[model samples]
Target: MRLSLKVWRQSNKEAAGGFEDYKLDNVSPDMSFLEMFDVLNEQLIEEGKEPVAFDHDCREGICGMCSMYINGRPHGPLRGVTTCQLHMRSFKDGDTIVVEPWRAQAFPVIKDLVVDRDAFDRVISAGGFISVNTGNAQDANSLPVPKEAADDAFAAAACIGCGACVAACKNASAMLFVSAKISQLALLPQGQAERSIRAEKMVAQMDAEGFGACTNTGACSAECPKEISLENIARMNREYIGAKFSSSAV
Candidate 1:
């Protein structure tokens, strides 16, 4: 396949950025999107041009680092798949693909298609973990949890924090991502000790990071590669309200 790519390029965060067009030929439909990029980079290197810089690690889709907006969709036109999993066959020959980074105030462009996602890390650090010791792995397992709760927690835990939710939202909201982290622990017995504080802190940090408010447009869940449910957001709102009430009563 022969294709034209319009890729966003920036030397650094403060630098002006724009699209640079390139023509890629002899492409294989079987090659993964990142693999095609590798080919493009090789071609650029041969011509002594600066290869595009994009974030990618463990191209198996496990890391969620291969973030890109292909055409107009996050992670390309596919549903429930990351850019690393996207293949050339998704597009036809002679296609003009536009690639850009996540557009949000909190996610400043680093270089090329890569954006600084440290805001997410800060939100996680605010309270995304279980600090309460459950004694040991065996002891933690002894706590009985309902089948439904376990399943829900597992689903919420599948969130890879790729920021697709923010990129997809018109307001650049991160409620879905924050809620998924909250629900993952809120549904489990092990996460009970700090449940109230966890919800409050994570949400507070998300707000502090300059992420926009959710308007229930469902764009976040729709664009999420993990397919994280919108129900998690509702649950988080409940958790936050409950935390506020509990704190007020004390």
Candidate 2:
């Protein structure tokens, strides 16, 4: 397959950036999107031109580090797949692909296709954890969690913090990602001790980081590679409201 890529390029976070076009020929349909970029980079290097910079850790799609907005969609046109998991075959021969980084104030572009997603890490640090004592591991049967709760918790925990939720939102909201993190713990018994505080702190931090409010547009879940549900957002809203009420009642 042959492709024309119009990719964003910037030298640094403060540097002005714009699209630079490149033509690629003889691309394999089986090649992952990152692999195609690798080929492009190699060609640029041989020509003494600077290579495109993109974020990618595990090509297997587990890391959520391959953050490219392909043709105006997060992670290309595929559903339930990350950028690294996107195949060149998803495009047609002679296609013109436009690639850019996540476009949210919270995720400022560092370079070509790499954005500083440390805002996510900061949100996680605010309160995305359980308070468990350090000791030998407890028996799995000790708590005896309800099957429904357990299932939901596990599903919510599948979120990989990819920031697609933010990229996909018209408001650039992090609600889906934040909700997934909150629900994963809020649904589990191990997370009870910090339940009341988790939602408040994380949501507060999310706001502090300049992430926009959830508009209920559902774009976040639609573009999420993990298929994290919108129900998580509802759960988070309940958790936050309940926490506020509980605190005020005291």
lDDT of 1 by residue, 10-104 (tens): 99999999999999999999999999999999999999999999999988887889899999989999999999999999999999999999999
Model 2, 76-115: lDDT tens per residue? Answer: 9999999999999899999999999999999999888899
Q: Lowest-lDDT window of 10 residues in candidate 1?
A: 132-141
Clashing pairs in 1: none
Candidate 2 is scored at a TM of 0.98
Q: Give the Cα lDDT of each candidate.
A: 0.94, 0.93
What is the clash tally of candidate 1? Answer: 0
C-alpha RMSD by candidate, in order: 1.4, 1.2
After superposition, which runs of candidate 1 have C-alpha atoms over 4 Å from their true positions? Answer: 134-141, 248-250
